[model samples]
Target: MSFKNLPLLGTAEIIGALNLSPKQTAAAANLAHRVTQSAWRRRPPHKSGQTYEEFAAAVSACAWLTMFEVGALLILGRHHDARILTEASRSVHQAAHTGRRR
Candidate 1:
């Protein structure tokens, strides 16, 4: 599938089309959800601005693209984008991991 087909599909569709492993797909989906939700929560109040949902969608889109790169890197065993993905996963996971400390 091409880039044009990406917007027409949801996370599951994209994941299936890419044939990513279950672990990779799950990480991508989780990242997408987190990015979207985080963007939503950051929606600001201003005279000129995009809605939170819109911001979230844009963020989710970018995250989805990065996720594709992640899957590709993992499949090829390349370390190029792995560090970025790993760092992001750690950051996102930390929110949950440290929740009990509060």
Candidate 2:
């Protein structure tokens, strides 16, 4: 499946919704990138696209999963900023990219 090239989204509203400072959001983004790269490194070339397409797929998958997680956490009243900033996005992106390769 081909992923549409999504426009880069503004994160100000999302950050406010999550009650995360810019610093925390940036940290999460950096961690997610690293994890995505690691996942890409292990992806089989025959199963994945060029760097841009594969990365786009990974990012799109990550965003969708993160939104679902954050929404669920908010509904359950379990959203913790530290937990989110530290590991949530990283794990989500890693899983997304890894699964995308199969």
Candidate 3:
């Protein structure tokens, strides 16, 4: 599958969709912002290393990692929690595709 086609979900949307407490949502957003900013700053110039597809995949992986961390911190360890996460991911994927088509 092409990683470039994957959907990108904002941190706020993920936290809100998961029904996390306001405080938790804020914390997750802050963490995501920090990590994303750091990654961008450390990334090599556009001419070097990975292609755009690879870079996007790396970013998606980072977002997934952040989601997992936030979920763990929020005690989202039940089956229902997994279901919610899956649903959120699917929603984001659909939204991305819809946007692309427009």
Candidate 4:
């Protein structure tokens, strides 16, 4: 059981995976769950439609959360929790050697 292979903290992939529908749901969880407003012209996407402008009047913009790299940043999370992976890996190792999932 070794956690030396893992590093903490990774941003989720959610750049343009959001949209609004024709009607609102009972509740909106996040920007992804917002409903579309009327007078919107374009081929509607699925309930959670997502898209951005291809051309702009000015230069294209680029933005992201700066917390991904900041002074004295310490990540307390993992893509897959190392603690759980250690146990699962140990189990797999045991099963490979002893033929048991336990």
Candidate 5:
């Protein structure tokens, strides 16, 4: 179960050594998939002159804004308050685009 052993083990072997329950394993897998997908999707263009740190910051900001929008939409439901979510999403989108163009 040591970090040093991780590199030598197959995925199943690692999972077994960790003794994760089925639900825990599934959740871990799902989280790993999400992280992988996000990394792939947000990877900066090669030779774009942007540092990895800058790209990561932008990606994190976008993800946070997206989650905020979703939460707002859910909380507002289908009521008139939904307009707030729409406006917030629009503002964030506009700001992101504006920042990128500078």
Candidate 6:
């Protein structure tokens, strides 16, 4: 089968769509994962402790990684590593496509 149309590359093609070497892509992916994790872990501003402006200011004042960008990076890595998607098929049957002509 030709890999010309597997459609694995994610929506964020801004980073040249898998143009980088595998090692670089892998490192980017790892960084993306860490960023995602941190984003998920960050606590939302408390309901009573801070006003919207204060919360916004606090967040803006801190050095923060962009989760959206990191997510894109992860997608790039996933494009190269089909196994990452394939592994999901074991539990999520819908994720698998055998590419059979019916």
* Most accurate candidate by lDDT: 1
RMSD of each: 10.6, 8.6, 10.0, 20.2, 12.2, 16.1
Q: Model 6: clashing residue pairs?
A: none
Q: Write the per-residue lDDT of candidate 1 for residues 9-83, one digit (tens) a residue.
A: 565565676677777665555554554556566665651277644564455454556655565556546575667
Q: How far is candidate 1 from the true structure (C-alpha RMSD, Å)?
A: 10.6
In candidate 6, which residue ranges exceed 4 Å CA deviation?
Answer: 1-7, 11-18, 45-102
Better of 2 and 5 by lDDT: 2
**Top TM-score prediction, candidate number:** 2
Q: What is the lDDT of residue 85 in candidate 3?
A: 64
Candidate 5 displacement at residue 87 in angstroms: 39
- Using lDDT as the yardstick, the better of models 1 and 6 is 1
Query: Which stretches of candidate 5 lie above 4 Å from their native place?
Result: 1-9, 46-102
- Candidate no. 4 TM-score: 0.22
Full-model lDDT, candidate 6: 0.40
Question: Candidate 4: minimum summed lDDT over ten consecutive residues — where?
Answer: 55-64
Candidate 5 steric clashes: 0
lDDT for model 5, please: 0.47
TM-score per model over all chains: 0.38, 0.44, 0.36, 0.22, 0.35, 0.31
lDDT of each: 0.57, 0.52, 0.55, 0.25, 0.47, 0.40
Alpha-carbon shift of residue 66 in model 5 (angstroms)? 27
Task: Candidate 1: give the clashing pairs.
Answer: none
Q: Which model is ahead, 2 or 4, in terms of TM-score? A: 2
Error of 5 at 21 (Å): 0.9
- Please rank every candidate by lDDT, starting with the best: 1, 3, 2, 5, 6, 4
Better of 1 and 2 by TM-score: 2
Residue 38 alpha-carbon offset, candidate 2, angstroms: 1.2
Q: Number of clashing residue pairs in every model?
A: 0, 0, 0, 2, 0, 0
